[model samples]
Target: MKLLTTNTLMVLLILISGYGYIASCTHDDIVPPAQANPTPVITRGENVHLPNATGVADGDTTKWKLDKAHSSVLWSTAYVGAAGLLTGRFNQFGMHDVTNAKMLKYPTPSRGQVLPDTSWAFYENDPSKIYFNGYVQMNTSNTGEPGRDSGCILGTGYYNTVKIIPGYQNLEINNLAKIKTTKVEFDPLSNDYIVTFDFIWQGSLASPLTQSIVGRLKYIPKAAVKDAVTGNVLYSVFGLQLNFQFDCRDFGVTSTSVADVIDIECNMNFNNK
Candidate 1:
């Protein structure tokens, strides 16, 4: 949700050195959309408390609604970090998480060599549907230059195409992103709403091929998550189920002839959450 270019440092340099492309970051606003029900993610008895002020109370159970105009979900997370450092919201933008597409994976190794980002549609007509589309970029440090940092393994682009089944059913995304909901169940043991996603590396040992990245792809949440209304209880999420199956494929070596799909399951909790 920051800059459009894959490399953030390059963006900074372009501004200072007057050699970067004009900033064209496009982010959409997310508000609940009008629908028959608030959201399946939220259940009636999910929360036992109610406010008399017509306003929702703490631990109120509400579905993750979409923005009618944007057709995107308002995914949020909690966090407690330094100012300008932690907004701690689910921070989900209008990503076209669908059948097959490119999505951006950040934290490039350096502050330069920024690449172009692809923005795809996450939804179109109905508010319930979702999509994710962007290109992934990663870099590393291989030199010990002073002041200005440079040199690291470059990475190949990876695309993700996932669907949020109408009824919140379950599916496995790249053997990492698991979604299951023929019947939805709340995880009382966990007090936080959970959405799991995985990123796989698909690079060749070559990048003599410029971006020869040699590491596994993992999904790390940068947004600080917190209880919807209160800015308390901040936490950032990292993938916990990577070892369960095959590790992320290396760049270029991955079989891009076909994309590896990762499924997403979002479960909202009441008390425990």
Candidate 2:
């Protein structure tokens, strides 16, 4: 994969299933919606490169602008999103359509640990304030290829952010880790940034810490199918909460320090000119 980006560097720190499936919300609460096609990786380009000097220095809240000219792809997970390298790119800007992605799990890895994860973060403006947000999905199933074919994790919600505090190497964004959604707007009314679409996140690789992983994502809301027996809508947009708790100090770890609130904002229109 290419080098990390500013936002992806921020999400440096930070799931389950089926009853197997946790039916927290019921449908029939909202009205019908329309559809519009957004930009995908395919129309984006064939490759991506990390421009020099775009990332923030320690404690710097410098904005990382999208180099629309030399830049092709938008998301940074472009490379990591896939497991094996492929011969071609897809129509959408996700991962290689046929390439296998690096599953984010390394059970009892000699060097890395994959928390029963569900949160991702990035340094806000400054390399200080980290935003953390993750909503656990109901089914811990496996989906196809993310933002591409049809799967990643076969679940209801998609949240991917894993920070290796005080990152492993001397990499500047080292101690930091993050990923960003497409550009969003600062909402004045809600007093919170709303990203209508595209959840963005990627992490410090810090070092080449590897592990075994099997997870699901993408909290896309679908029309709750009428129950086979009752013909009733079954799910709604419910606000379910999950706390990703882990004390790095307990693992004989004294390197990276957790930040305050790492808020992954949603509710913005991230496509188009």
Candidate 3:
């Protein structure tokens, strides 16, 4: 046995500490460790930075150019009478420019108050006053199963035993304009603009069906940043969320395994691009 000097013991301790740190940092399966739980730590502080101004400046007829990259549409249908649900999303779509949108104050949140008002109203005479225009290509849909996606949506072999033609190829949900909100409401705290609109769907089934539907839009505001040089701040950045339901039978989607009615939800975020 040899006695270790003080210098040698210090070197050994440093090597052990370094090795332990390296081992702790290395991942087992190339996955990082869970992050610390997020919680508000600041109660009051003078170092806090606040925006110079913040409000939805767009008036009753604010024309917004949608940010397509950040926008998306998702849909889900019952697999068998609510026993299970199959959800999918549309990869390609666009929002037609808005002409004149009605403006309403956001309802003040209170204790035991319901958040979303479900009462909806529609235009009787003219349906073009305010509407949403968008389309979904049947081929671009995804339901987590490649075989089912290609066969059911694209009419590949999986849909039918003999490989029949796809029933619905492209669905154009145009003329969603007749939908009139009973009242326009904005959430001041979250800057969420609430409106209900009627959506029209033009199906490409064997019979070429057409139907009108209603939905709700929760237009929430995204964060804004100020220019470093000019100090001009960016504002009015918003994202519109739509959730609605429609019958698949109307569009000729008569699959016993799938449900008759499908629920659609979309989110469209807009910026000053």
lDDT (Cα atoms) of all candidates against the true structure: 0.25, 0.24, 0.46
**For residues 127-212, what per-residue lDDT tens digits would candidate 1 score against the true structure?**
12222222211222111332212211121122232322332222123211212111112333332222223333323432211121
Candidate that beats the other on TM-score, 1 or 2, i.e. the better one: 1
Model 3: weakest 10-residue lDDT segment is 47-56
Q: Residues 1-273, candidate 2, lDDT per residue (tens digit)? A: 345675565555312333223444334445558676563322111111111132212222221212122222111111233453211111111111111132322233233112211132222222122222222111222223444323232112212222223322211221222222333333334322333222221222323122221111112221233578988864322111111122222222222223222222122111011
TM-score, cand. 1 vs. native: 0.21
Ranking by TM-score: 3, 1, 2
Off by over 4 Å in 3: 1-64, 97-130, 153-204, 226-236
Clashes of each: 46, 64, 3
The candidate maximizing TM-score is 3
Query: In candidate 3, which residue pairs clash?
Result: 106-186, 131-177, 179-198
TM-scores for the candidates: 0.21, 0.19, 0.47
In model 1, the Cα lDDT at residue 187 comes to: 34
Q: Which RMSD values do the candidates have, in order? A: 28.8, 31.2, 16.0
